[model samples]
Target chain A: MGLVNSIFATVQFEILRVLTLRRLSVAVIMALFPPTMIFWLQAGGALASPGFIITLFCGMVCLLSLLLWSTSNVYAELEGKSWAFITSRPYGRWSILFGKFLVAFLVSFIISWIALSLCMLVTGDLDFNILNDGKEVPKMQVWLALSGLLFLASMVYAAIFSLLGVLIQRRAMAIAVVFFTVVEVVFAVIPAVVGKFAMSFHMFCLLTHWVGWVPPSAGQDEDANEILQDFLNVYGRQDAWVHLAVIFAMTLLSLSLAAYVICKREYITLEDSQV
Target chain B: MIEFHNVTKLYKTVIGVNDISLKIEPGVYGLLGPNGSGKTTFINLVMGQLRPSMGHLSVFGMDPWQNDGLLNRIGLCPAIQAHYPFISGLKWVAYLTQLRGFSRKQSHQMAAESLAVVGMEYAMNRAMSSYSLGMRQRTVLAQSIAHKPELLILDEPFNGLDPKGRYEMTVFLKSWVKEGRSVILASHILHEVESLNPSLLLVSGGRLLASGSPQQVRSIIANCPNSVRVRCRQTAELAALVTGNFEIKSISINSEAEELEIESMNPLELLKLLPGLAMKNNLLISELRSSDDSLQNIFSMLMLIHRGGMRLPE
Candidate 1:
């Protein structure tokens, strides 16, 4: 119980620091970049599909910013030689990593959500008439589904990056690039079972099922959001619940690996921190 | 409070610490050694930051490596050159204390009190990066003591302090010892370690050479011969008088240089007797000093023994 509270206190302290005027301003700029760019493209009359644009923005810009922050959580300690402060605490290593991971995830999720809402400001009347001639799906449902996907993506990406920090903190930026380029982007873009291993794979499946273009049916509103309504299996491309479970499981697995490494490895900072 | 049995820590091809055994029933113990003498490695073993390549170590009767309970009872003020730039000293200490299971109110209160004790209360709100070296050292010390652990380990805590800061740290450490908590102070400087505690463990070349109070260490070296040099008009007379004393093991005089060299088993006693003897001989002792610094001699002896080329007197 004390450990849990301690973790929360750390997260609280970190989040506060992270949201300081200077860092928060940078976060806001980065978060709003996607929507601002989308708005500009739409104004230029060169915008193709808004869904594709928004998803790309979330995956690329939002994920990158979040990944950068989460990865830095561990590397910052190393670079600053402040790992002693956290490792020397009674709650120990795992709690420290978990606290960092949580703060990063929450910060990224909140910023991304704010960015999504800002996009709505430009997209206008997102009582969106994204129709494929099927039964009308409410705009509220579309928003809810997109929000869920964003939340899960934030969580999964944060965990993976946090794991990378635990594994190879000194090379965090370089490893992050390799992981993002190879796994999240290239693997996710390709249509293979191997892509299923990436967080983007589940996100793409969820996106497709939630807003996939459906075949035209008679006696249906022509300008309605055509979305799957199987609450448990919303994106029936594959089971959404199963994908959710996989993502959560991967988070747990990554967290466990991080904890194990932290507990077992003899970090120089820890050794030299002896008072 | 701490124990090591045949503990050896090997880093690939180099041995950071060699086979050794020790038990510390601590009030305050100074770990004295030069750079690369395994002081940090030994401290790391005690803190459970590293596992022994062979043998075993225990602190507070629990294994330190990943032992959260044991760690909770220990506080460390590591010897670091800098502090985190982004976090204020107050926040860092409070956050660490909170992690030690203290309530938010308690953590903050303890942090404030600890900072006050270290005379850092005025600048506690400032980011650590803004602090001067002395201030940073104080802040680090504050964070370690905020939890009020049973044992506190300070690794060269006075490394970068100004003279006044060093004096204040000595006073605080003295008071802390009076409070009956255990402390392990690691330092390279002899006088500094001597100032903190008479009891010490000296290491050289990754091996423990000596362990005892200052008086005991002095006694061990009492009969070890060391050279005393003298330049005087009456070198012959001075050498004759000095060599006659049992404390003086041998003597040689050079009339050409008006110099006298005496090797003494009991150098302190010989030193005490020199002036009296010189006066009796009516010798003008223009210059007189021991060429041998005792600390350096002890270290040389230890290294010799470590290399298996010399035997330490039982």
Candidate 2:
């Protein structure tokens, strides 16, 4: 109960901090990026396909925003000379970590949702009456499913970035960008067992399952069918529940590791006065 | 309620505090030292923000490192200034109070009360950037005291405060000590802590040079050798006369500046003899200066004495 109160207080402070005009404006600007990109693509006569939206637009925005907010959780306080004040409080470090993680996930997820809403409004993708596997599948349903998966992805990524912040205090953001490029982007696409370790791989796997991938008609596109088969083989044609379980486990594991590392680590903020 | 058992903290090649072993009872203490003399390092170690590189330290009978519960009883008004420009003093204090596990309403009330005690009730609603340095200092003090910690560790708490603020802070600390709570006040200036009449802990070069009451430390400083630099018309005559009559430790004559630097065992007695000796010799003394007046020199002398004791075969 005491820990809960501490976390709640920290959450309140974090919310107050985010609600400031400057920070809110930044958040709004970041949220507008994905929708603006979709609008630009639509103006160029490109289809706002579910696969493109899920993989490129929503995924990139979530990762970037989470990286921006979550990867500096500890570093920002240390740099601002507020770490001593906070860390000296009872249960302060743990509460602040959980509070910041919660806020980071919420802000990133909201940004993605706002971007999706604007994308739907600008591109008219909401009234998606496209057909899949001889059944009329609304693009709106696919988007909603993608949003759910994006929520889970945001939680996992926030935990991962926050853990990175704790582990690498000074260069957390730079290192996280590298991790994104190397692991999420490169390793996730590799056709090997290592791909399964990437959070993006499981997100894509779940995306493929939730939004049914309608294969090309028999004999209509042999090449496309082969490519689809190979892609499925790489990502694995796992059940949606299995992918969901994987994401849940990944989020739990990341959060647990972050908590353990944060609690054990000593943040030495070398201020001018400390000398 | 604090103990350091041969504890040392090293910052790579530089040492923060070296082999410091002492126990602090429940009372106000002045951790006195010059700037960069490891007073902040000692406070950091006690606050559990630092881990000793060697030996052991305990507060409230438990190892202070990572001891969250123990920190509930300790508050620190650090030397560094607060940098939250956009937030009001009230909100900042309240936010930190909430971090102490209080309800939102309760934290606000407690923050307000603490700010009021520190004479910041009016400007608590203003942004911190708009505050004077003294206001910021008081706000930081409010945060440290809001939780009513049993032990308050303040690092240079009087850095930017005016005389009035200093008096109030001293009064508050005196009352706090009277309540049986312990206060460890760290300052580079001697008189800042002298007002509180705290037990003195003189530190220099990361080592505990001396520990005693204010009077005790002052008596030791009195006994330390005093050097007086006298500029006079009869430099050689005065140096010889002073050396002959009094127990002058050393003398150096500077012909260029017409100055005679004299080290005296008893400065009071030498100062008394200077006028009569100068009148008798018909020497006009232009200037008189004492080297032991500055705080740094006093600490250096104490350090020398400490080193001498350490050099003795154990």
Candidate 3:
């Protein structure tokens, strides 16, 4: 019971810290970037397929915001010179890390849901007509399933980025940028077994398995079929359950590692009075 | 309540505290030293903020590093002045109080009470950035004592406070000591530490020069070099009389001013000898002053011993 109160205090403080007006502005801009781009592209007669909506809403909006918020939020206390005051109490490091991870995950989840929902509404893709394997899928079920996907992405990515922040605090920004560019974008699409290691690979896999692929008909032109096949193959490599399990396990591992690091290392803050 | 067995802390090439062993019982004990004299380093070691590089240290019979056993029983009022500018002092203290495992409601009450203890009750609702330096220091003190810790470790607690604040804090600390709590107060200011209590641990060059009552610390360096200026009607005769005395180290005679500046190994002895020597030589000793008994003088004496390889007075 005592430990629980410590963790709760940390969680409450994290919520307060992350929900500031400046951070809210960053979150707002993060959530709107993709949908606004989608609308602008739509004006130029750009494609508005299901694939397009998934990439815009899930890849750009959901994943990027989680990345942006999680990295800074983990190390924010130390940066602001508030770590000593908070950590010097009975509250241990495990409690502090757990609180930060929970806040990052929850905020990312909420922002992803709201932003993706807005995208669907504006793009006229909120149709209550999702059919899977010739079975009528309810509109409410589809909404819930999509919400679950957004939550999953936010949960996993936030944990990973938070772990990064803990492991390499001073270089968190540079390390995160390099990791996302190298692993998520470049290597995740290499069509090799090594590409399976990236989080984006699992994200694509989960999406493909959740929303079954509908191949373009044989009567269709080769160019259209080729585009559809490449898209399907890129995102349809593994079973959805496997992807879900991997994401969940990785989240647990990252959060645990982050807690361990916090507990062990001494944070030598530049707080001495130069007498 | 605290023990350090041959403990030393080194920051790469620089040594913060050297191999030193000592013990302290529960009372208000001052850790006195000038700037860069290992006062902060010793406080950090006791607070579990920095682990000793060699040897062992324990507080309340347990390793202080990451020890949650006495988390509620040890409070630290740090000297650093970092604070969140956006929040009121009440909110900041309350937040830290909650971190001590109190319910939010209980924390609120305790924080207000502690703030009141520091005479910040009226200003608790104001943003900390808008506060004067003394008010901010009080707020930090409130956070440390809000949990009702059994041992309070304060580092340079008198840095920015006015005389009034210092008096209030001194009173509160005396009352606190009277209640059977222990405090390890670190400060470079001599009279400030002296007012808290006569017992102090004198440290210099990362080594323990002396540890006992203030008088004992003073006795250890009794042979420290003293600078004395003597103005006489006949300066040459006084210098001639005092030049070969066993107490005097060096002498400089200024003819135009009719003064003799003398450095002595023992000022007290030289003072006793001066009047008689003047009388014997029939030289009128008009003015005499010894500028080597104050706080800074003691530190200067310690440094001279440290650098000049002079041992402490027996």
Candidate 4:
């Protein structure tokens, strides 16, 4: 009970610390990203397809927000002089990391939702049937499905970035961006069994399975659907539960790994080290 | 209580502390050293912000590395300044107290009282960025003592403090120790640590040179060769008289300043002989200064003793 209370206090402390105007401004910028991109696509006469929009929300808006907030959580404290004050408390180090992770997850989740809503507004896609091909899925149903995907993506990305922050404090942000590009972006899209291991793979699989989202190329290339279908057939289209399970497991694994490393490794400021 | 058994900390290539094995009992212990002498590193090792690269360390009978239970009994006022610009001093202290498992109300009460103790109650509501360095130091001290831990480890607590603030801190530390609690104060200033009258731990070059009561350490320092600089009109005559009467190790004359600098194996006898020699010879002595009292010279002499290059007077 004492430990739980301490953790809650840490969360409250983080809330106070993270509520500055600079951080809020960054959140606003993240919220505005997807809609601005959608507006630009519409002006260019590009198909602002549901797949592109979903990917933008999950990969760009959500991940960008996490990259800003989560990847620098530990680094910021150590770089500043506040590392000792918190790390010296009982369960202080662990609680601080956990609190930052929670705040990062929620902030990214909220920003992603706002981005999705603004994107929908920009496209005037209130019907949300753009993905279901006139099969008349209720607007709220599709909205909830998209919201679920964003929530999962936010959790997974936040946990992963938090681990990166702990593992490599000096270059966490740059390395996280590179990891996102190479692993989540490039590797997740490969039409092979190895792609299933990436968190983004489960996210896209759930998006296609739940929201009936198809690739933007499906309308232009006649065989794009056949290729996607062939790929899914070979991979065996699992249930939505399987994708969700994989994502949740990845999130848990990342968070646990971060906790393990943080508990085992000694983190000190350069000033302290040199002294 | 804390114990280090052959503990050494290596930061990649640089050594922080080397082969330090000691047991610290409950009391006030001043970790004394010059700048960059690994005093902070030793404190960090005790705080568990660092782990020993070799050997082992235990605080309160438990390994301090990731020892959450042990930390509950310890409070650390680190050398690093707090940098939360937006939060008030009260909130900052309260937040840290809350992490000690206190309820919000209790934490605030404790923070308030602790801030009051450190003479920061009036400005506790102001944002930290608006604080003077002394005010921030007071706030940092408040947070460390707010939880009333059994052990309070302060690294350079007197830094950024006015004389009045230093006095208040000394009084507070005295009271804290009178309560039977322990403190480990780390500082490079000898007088600042000396005023506390703490058991001294002198370190140099990442090694513990000596550890004992103030008198014990002072006695060892007293035996080292003492250098005295005298500004006098008759530099040559004074130098000649001092060399003949006292056991002088080295003598150097600065012709421009008309000063005679002398190193003596027995500083007391040399100092006693100075006034009479000047009075008898009508030599005007303007200034007299000793280098042996300084921490740098004391440490150099201790290092020499540790390296078998010098020995204490019999």
Better of 2 and 4 by TM-score: 4
Which pairs clash (backbone N, Cα, C closer than 3 Å) in model 3? none
Q: Least accurate stretch of 10 residues (summed lDDT) in model 3 chain B?
A: B216-225
Top DockQ model = 4
Residue pairs that clash (backbone atoms under 3 angstroms), model 2: none
Q: After superposing candidate 2, which stretches have Cα over 4 Å from the reference?
A: A46-55, A125-131, A134-136, A214-226, A272-274, B229-237, B249-260, B265-289, B309-314
Report the lDDT tens digits of candidate 2 across residue range A65-162.
Answer: 89888999999988988888988887788887898898889989999878776776776633333344436557677678768877997898898898
lDDT of 4: 0.83
The alpha-carbon lDDT assigned to residue A195 of candidate 1 equals 74
**What's the ranking of the predictions by DockQ, best on top?**
4, 2, 3, 1
Per-residue CA lDDT of model 3 for B238-313, tens digit only, reads: 8878876646778888999988899887866777788888888788998888756566668767766766667654
Docking class of predicted structure 1: acceptable
Candidate 1 deviant stretches above 4 angstroms: A19-22, A125-143, A189-192, A213-236, A270-275, B219-277, B286-298, B311-314
Per-residue lDDT for A38 in model 4? 75
Q: Please, what are the lDDT tens digits per residue for candidate 1 over residues B73-105? A: 888887775555677888878887888888888
> Which candidate's TM-score is highest?
4
Please rank every candidate by lDDT, starting with the best: 4, 2, 1, 3
Q: Candidate 2, what DockQ?
A: 0.57
- Candidate 4 chain B worst ten-residue window by lDDT: B266-275
What are the lDDT scores of the predictions, listed in order? Answer: 0.76, 0.81, 0.74, 0.83
lDDT of 1 by residue, A36-145 (tens): 98789888965555655665676566677766777876668767766766777767576678888888788788888777767766777533434533545565566666
TM-score of chain A of 2: 0.89
Provide per-model DockQ scores: 0.36, 0.57, 0.40, 0.71
Model 4: docking quality category: medium
